[model samples]
Target: MFNIDLFPQALKSDENGQTRSCLLQQTTMGESVTEQELWFAYPMNLPMPEDDDCDSYLLATLLPAMQLRAAIRVHGSVSHELLANLTELQYVWSKWLPERYFLIDIQVDRIRDQDLQVESAIAAFSGGVDAQFTAYRHATGRAGYATRDIKAGVFVHGFDIPLDDTEGFNSAVEIATQVLSDINVDLLPVKTNVRALWSIDWEEYHAAAIASVLCGLKRYAGIGLIGSGDSYDVLLTPWGSHPITDPLLSCGNFRIIHDGAGFRRSEKLIILSSWSIGIRNLRVCWAGNKHDKNCGHCEKCVRTRLNLLLAGVDNPACFDTPIDSSLFRFMVLKSDAVRIDWSLIRQEIIETGRGLEWLPYIEKVLKRKSSPKLSGLFPFGSKRRMWVKKMLMRNK
Candidate 1:
């Protein structure tokens, strides 16, 4: 059995005058695994309910790893409805990735729906295209919500940046603060070692991780907006963050909204291009270093640069250097998401009668195999090899 204990909330202030409210945890699984005093810290300056509610915090922190162990004992209050939704959501998630399927036993007190209180609206802001688009639309009243009602933007250090990297964490805070400030929104930073505590597939469990962070702030934020990674039109199965799974994460007073599903990657850029802050402070590099904002050579950075160029708003403010089309010659488009984005960029080039300049790179990408097939690993007959090649070409 896996036991999780949520200790009473504690308030602490740093030397810099910033205050943090923390919900600390202690987890143990027999003699194999033991995590003591793990914490989820939230900025305390933001508005919060009169009563301390640790239900949302427990759900967010323990749900992802519950299945890995046989049973979970959460010593905190949780919503009965939210618990049911999470149970069902886990079923759907396991179906998509059978390798991760495992039975989970849950034990916790349930909070009645009538006792829930209202909370302010907030979105996860990472200074990326998807997050920026969500913040811009919701904060500008373009999404039909009052601009001022959306209270603040939440940034998590352990999600993208490692928990131990103080330099990266500080840089992300600096960037997120500048971006949110330009839009007249407060920045709420949360620090946690949740990812380090739980050993799960990052791609498959990131949605749960993100939702947990938002839920941890449920006392302050009622509606948590999670930016969509892929648009609804081309949404593939087995994705961590989807329109279906995100909304189910809501319980009692806190609701998780999967924002920006209606817009494509290209369309989102067009919307963000109108905002100077979005253009000037966009950070999309997965290969970014602690010293540099964007490495300018990674697959993600190259893709974003191409999309910005195709959108007609490519500038030094957004990227340190111009789009190096030659980089495409070396990049192998692996995932469906990257391929889809490249396809859209390809169509844009063709429509603008600029295909000749990019034809070589596009053809190279099309000729490359789709993810490696089993046949590539073992010696196979010509017939099987030929079939795999055709499938790869057809996918392109």
Candidate 2:
């Protein structure tokens, strides 16, 4: 059996900021690896609470435990509500992806009760389309009663921007800070090494990692808003973050809400088009270049440009160069979900009678066939095969 031991360490103050860490020791199949640390660092002025619980560590390590079929035993306090919610969360995951993931056992020494105090919410902000939509609606009271009072927008350094990319992270943070500040929300920069700890699939592990970060910052906010990538009409199953599973990550006083799934990417962009601050400062590229925030050549950058153009914005300030219509010829959408996004863009262009010049390129993207290997593997159609196709498309 796999064993996971959680040991909370004292807060360390360094030149960068205050770091709260937990030492994770994993042992499996008669082999062990120690010295792995899961930590979150905040600015000097942001003081973290003294809550000595392993909830964050448990959430962060859940995917690894399931992969190893490990029974997790925490040496520190964990919330009873979180443990109970995890049962349902695992049920959803195992049900969706039976081949890759299954339910695992979890245990803890002390179970803490919920905090009765109420506090404002915090959102995971990457300066992307979804995140900006969520932040803008709530800040402008467009969400009405369902709106959350977001105290701060959390910009995680290690998620999109790598831990070693200190300069890139700081630069991106500056842009995110400015955009959030325009909506009257403060920016909280956080750093973590959870992704480096394991070789798990990032598509399945990212939400858990984000939840762990939010849980660790429960001292500052009670509610966490994870922006949704797809709307209800085009929901993608077996995804890391979804409207169904995001709420299950909540524990006791901390709540996770998946926001902005009601509108499509193009629809959301249309609304955000009016928000000048968000439009100018959007940073959605994952090209790994330190200097360029949005490389117009990448698939994501090209997609965002198309979305912006459909929304009636041309040559957005966030992108240095305009998207080339011919770029669609070489682009292969990695997933059916992304293909659907492009299809929706095409439909929007047709319906609005705008951006008609780019329809042929969008059609080229839509007409492209699936990988030959995938077609060969799933020649005999079945429910299981269809699900497998969807899952494989994500990784392809």
Candidate 3:
């Protein structure tokens, strides 16, 4: 069994103005493994979890426990509401990815009492398309009554930007802060080594990680909004951050919402493009250097460019490099998700009678076939293309 022992130490602060909470984790497969300390850091001004608050730890450790096929024993207090939700969470994961994840036992020392109602919310923001859409829609009242009272945008360092990239993180946070500030929202910066410290797969485990981090602010807000990557129409399952699994991560009065699943990426871009601050400062490239802006050559960059062009933004300033039809020759539709994204653009162009010149390039990229291994040569690195193809196809 894996054990996460919450030491009674107060939150620690360093000269760098960062405050962090730590927990000692010990895992046993057959023989005992080495002990490791898991920690999450936030800016000193942000609200953090109490010393004995174990909800975050419980959620953070679930994926690891399932990966090890070992039950978990928590030596701290966890929210009774969260404990109940975890049962359904395990069942869903086990059913979805039986080959890699399994249901595991979870035992807690004591159940933490629930809090009074909390109405404010904080969203997980990476200054990406989905995140901007969630933030803008609610802030601008475009979501109508369904909009949340988003208090701040939580930007994490170690999630997409590496923990070691201080300069890069600072730069990204500056852009995020600017984007959020324009919407009358604050930016809460957090730093963590969760991904670097663990051996778990990131694609399937990222949502839980986001939940764990945001749960730290449960004292300040009752709701956490995780911006949805794909709309409900083209839902991506067996991957991380699905609508079905995101809500299950909620515990006690703190609710987890998978926001912006109702709108397609192009639709979201149209809404955001109308906003001067959001469209001008948008940051979505994942293949470039951590410190650099959009590379304009990656598949994602090209797709975003296409989305902007379709939105009638002839030349968006967010991307320094211009996307041309010649770039599609080097592009590869690695996963069905990528193919679907481009296909949607093609369909939208036909429907709107705009950007028709790029139709041939999009068709060629989707139709051309290549070995999965060849995808490694691309900028964002390689994935199990064939396996993802099968999973998405089967699920659809």
Candidate 4:
């Protein structure tokens, strides 16, 4: 059983004299792990959900991780509607990963009208391709929504960056602030140790974790836009954030919008290429640190650089170094989605008749050559299989 304890909001002033309210959650599970506390400090002047409204907040925030441990052992109570939503989410999880699924038993009391006041829409901003595209579209009213209604961008520290890496968090804040400021949107930096508290897969638990943050701000936002990592055609299974699961995370007050399912990563890059903000501040490095712009050598960095080149927006200023063709010799293309993206990028290069110098290298990278197996009739049997998969991808 897991328990959630909501502490009263505490207003405290930082060294800079800026005041902020600290929203706290203490979660205790039976036997498996020790009690963990999560703190979210928001600007004190901003209107937020009151202590009475914490039931829904806890439901969204604590339930996913708690369900993984034991049944939800609520310290106080939860709403029936949220319980139902969570139960459904658990079902979805079970379908996604049957090995990880378990029945969710809740300690709750039925409550009515637990929804907070509806207000503006906000998108998760991470200075990445998907997030930047979402922010750009929504902020410019291109998403078929009111531009001004989409207000601020939310950046959480613990999701992408390590919780203890204060320097990295500060760096991310700087980039996110600059990116959102260009679109005339406010940037809300949320600090949490939720990842540290629970032993959950980042890919599986991310959507729920992000939904929790947005739900906590129910008094402030009505629609929470989560940037989609995959396109509709190639939605990756076992992914935490998806078009299907993201919308289901919505409750009476908050609606989690999975933005940018229509556009592929390359397409999103093309859209962002025209935007000066994206050109200058686009960050897509998995191996980046507080000190570097982008390592420019990691798989993600290399791919982004290639995409930018294909989009005609490749700039040396945005990346620490030029695309090293040598990296492709050993760089492994692990997932089908990644391989697909690379194939699209290769096609773009061919169609445009540009970047022909890199074609041989790209082909070499895409052609997966596996090692020989002892039981195989043919030498390089796995390599033959890999060749078949590569041919299928090319034909498709």
- Model 3 lowest lDDT segment of ten: 373-382
Instruction: Give the residue spans of candidate 2 off by over 4 A.
Output: 31-35, 369-396
What RMSD does model 3 have? 5.8
What lDDT does the true structure give each of the candidates? 0.68, 0.81, 0.79, 0.67
Q: In candidate 4, which residue pairs clash?
A: none
- Better by TM-score, candidate 4 or 2: 2
Q: Residue-wise lDDT of candidate 4 within 15-62, one digit each (tens)? A: 432222224343444434444445555554566654444443454444
TM-score of 3: 0.90
lDDT of 2 by residue, 1-396 (tens): 777778888888888899888887878777866558888888786646564678888899888778777778888888888998898988888898888677888878888886543588999888999999999999888887889999988888777776767888888888888899898999988988887677676777788999998887787889999999989988888889999999989988899999999998888999999999899988888742543287666678888998898888999999876777666767777777677778888888989998899899888877887543342343222355446645644543
The candidate 2 region of ten consecutive residues with least summed lDDT is: 373-382
Q: By the TM-score metric, which is better: model 1 or model 2? A: 2
How would you encode candidate 1's per-residue C-alpha lDDT over 16-89 as one tens digit per residue?
Answer: 33322334444555445444445566664554432345555555554455555545555545677687787888
Residue 74, model 4, lDDT: 45
Q: Which regions of candidate 3 are displaced past 4 Å?
A: 1-9, 370-396
* C-alpha lDDT of candidate 3 relative to the true structure: 0.79
Candidates in order, TM-scores: namely 0.82, 0.90, 0.90, 0.80
